[model samples]
Structure formats: structure tokens, C-alpha cells
Target: MIEVEVEAGAWTAALPDAEAVAARAAKAALGTVEGDVVVLLSDDAAVRALNARFRDKDRPTNVLSFPAPENAFPHLGDIVLAHGVCAEEAQVQGKTLADHLSHLVVHGVLHLLGRDHEDDAEAEEMEAEERDILAGLGVADPYAAEREGRA
Candidate 1:
């Protein structure tokens, strides 16, 4: 079971189906995993606050994942998206806002399921899973930009 609580103020008008997009992405990422996820659709300022409080960062990012401690709850964790950053990235990356948001949800859920990119091997594996999951939803691979110029 997955539950995504979206908190979007003025951005709500732009993403009419934010919940659906998040659900689709989360469900795909949880193929073999289990747990509910919380999603927050906020602006850069809100995200920046979260980043500073949690990760010790001081800037807004596209997405931030907070995984529940091992077996702590029925919930996987929370996935917060900075709408401003997401929109900017989507435009720069040539992707639709919805598609980009979906990708970020998938990426966040993967982290909750213990997927990380702290190392090369882990990154490749996680990226592969991301591509596979996103492909099922007709979303282009989010890592396409990173792979450019590679064989």
C-alpha cells in the first residue's frame, strides 16, 4: 500500500494530477518493495528549509527523500519535491513537468528501498532500475543527459 500526501499551494493549478503522477512512479519503484510514501509538492523555500534541517544543506533541490528507519513504520518515507527546481530542471532537460516529477518520485522511492548512488556500482544498478521502471510508464530515462557522449 502507498499513500502520497501532496502539499502544493499555488503550484496545484499547474499539476492537476500530481497525486496520480506520484502514485504511478511510487508503485513502479515498489515493484518488489513494500511501504507507503508521503509526497510534498512545495516551493524552493520550503524545500530549502527541509534540506537545511535534514541534510545540512542550504539550498533547494529538485527532490529530497527521507527514509523511515529500518522497520520503523508501515510507511517507506517521505519524498519532497521542490516545484520551482523541478520545473526549471524539466525545461532544461527537455522533459515535461509531469514526467520530470514522476522521475523524481521514482528516484526518491528507490532510495527508501535502499538504493543509493554513493558508489559507481551502486549508481549504475540504481540507474538501471530507474530506467526500467520509468520505461514502463513511457517516461524517458532521466539519466539520458549523464550518458551523453558515452558508448
Candidate 2:
């Protein structure tokens, strides 16, 4: 199961269907993975605080994923998204907020499922997976611009 909690007002104001968008994205990412995920729709301040507390980074990022311990089994983890950062990135990437949000949710859920982009090979594999998943949802290739040297 996937749960979406909108903790920021901007999310709804910008996309009234934010929760549905996130839930659908999360479900798409789950595929063969089994677990429950909690998605938090928050602001930069909250995400910055979380980044500082957990990653020692005092900056707000678009998304963050905290995986559950092994013993937790079916309870996968939590995925948090910062509305401000996501909105800014979407605008810069020339994508809709919903598309970007879906991409980030998939990215975060992949992390929770033990997928990582720590190395080039890993990044390529992960990007491929993301592309396949996003395509299924009718979202364009998010890395197209980057591949074309436009990002």
C-alpha cells in the first residue's frame, strides 16, 4: 500500500491532484517489490531539516528516501518531497509539476527498494528502470535534456 500525506499547502495549490499523482507513481515503482510506503509532501524548510538531521546536509533537496530496517520486512520506508524544490526543478526542466513529482516519487521508492545510483553503471541501470516506469505512466524521458547536453 502507498500512503500520501500532504504536509504543505503549496502542493495542493499547485496541483490539486498531488496525492493521487504521488500514489500512482509509488505504485508504479513498487512493481515486484513488496512493501508499504509513506509519502510526505512537504516544504523546503521541513526537507532541509530532515536532510540536516539524517544526511548532515543543511540543504533542501527535491526528494529524500528513508528505508526501513530489514526486520521491518513488508513496511518498505518513507519518501519525502519538497514542494518548492520540486516546483523549481520542474520549471527548469520544462516539465509539468505532476510529471516531475511522479519521477521523484519513483526515484525515491526505487531507493527504498535498494536501488542506488552511487556509480555510473548503477546510475545507468537505475535510469533505465526509471525511464521504463515513467513511460508506462505517459511521462516523457526525464533525462533527455541531460543526454542532449541541454541540462
Candidate 3:
């Protein structure tokens, strides 16, 4: 079973159906991996700080994932999301905020499962997995939107 702990830090509005989204994303990404994951929803400033600290990037990102060590038992690490960025991306992509958020959650979960898209080939694989998972959740292909200049 997959477990999720949600932390709403510096977010203005409450996330609607956050638990369900997290659960779905976890299941889609890890399949039957028994573990606990933490999801944090925060404002742009917090996410930006985290990005700067962890990734050495100064800009705020939509989502960031930090995976636990291999020795850790039933713990998949954490996913941090910037609510403001997500909303803005959704607006720019012409998709609902919830859909964008769902996509990001799934993407982060995939990262926790040791998935990376740093290279073209790896990106293709990761995007394929994201497409399949998002499709199961009734979300359109996020990469397609990007390719069409809609995201």
C-alpha cells in the first residue's frame, strides 16, 4: 500500500481532492510498492528556496522530488509543489489547475521511483510513463501540450 502525507505550507487555497490525487499518482508511478511519501504544497517563495537549496537553481519550479535512500524502508521521499507556479502553468497551458497539479504529482512520484528525464532518451521514457499514468487518470498528454505550444 502507498501512503501519502500532505503538508500545505504557504498555500493560499486548500487543495481539492489532494489525497485522492496523491494516491492515484503513487499507484500509477510505483505500482504496488509499499511505502510512504510526503507531498508538500507551498507558495512560490518556499518552492524557490527549496530549489535553490537542493538543486542549486534559483528559480521556482513546478515540482521537486527528493527520493529516500535505498536502505530506507517503506519511505519514498518527498514531493514539493509550488501552488502559484502550478496555477500559472495551468493558465498558460489551457488546462485546469487540478489537472496540471495531478500531472506534476505523478511526475514527482515517478522521480521517487528512480525515474529521470535528464537526457533525451530518458525523457522519452519518462514522458511515456507520465502519459500512460495521466491517461489512466483522464488527463490529456502533458507533453503534447508542450509540443503544441499550449503548455
**lDDT (Cα, tens digit) per residue for candidate 1, span 6-69:** 6765456777888788888889889976567787788899999999999999999999999988
Q: Over 4 Å off in model 3, which ranges?
A: 1-15, 149-151
Would you estimate the TM-scores of all the predictions?
0.93, 0.97, 0.87
Candidate 1, residue 131: Cα displacement in angstroms equals 0.1
C-alpha lDDT of all candidate models, in order: 0.87, 0.97, 0.81
Give me the displacement of residue 37 in model 2, in angstroms.
0.3
Q: Tell me model 2's lDDT, rounded to 2 decimals.
A: 0.97
Expressed as tens digits, the lDDT of each residue in 53-103 for candidate 2 is: 999999999999999998997889999999999999999989999999999
* Weakest ten-residue segment in model 3 by summed lDDT: 5-14
C-alpha root-mean-square deviation, each candidate: 1.4, 1.3, 2.6
- lDDT leader: 2
* After superposition, candidate 2 runs with Cα above 4 Å error: none
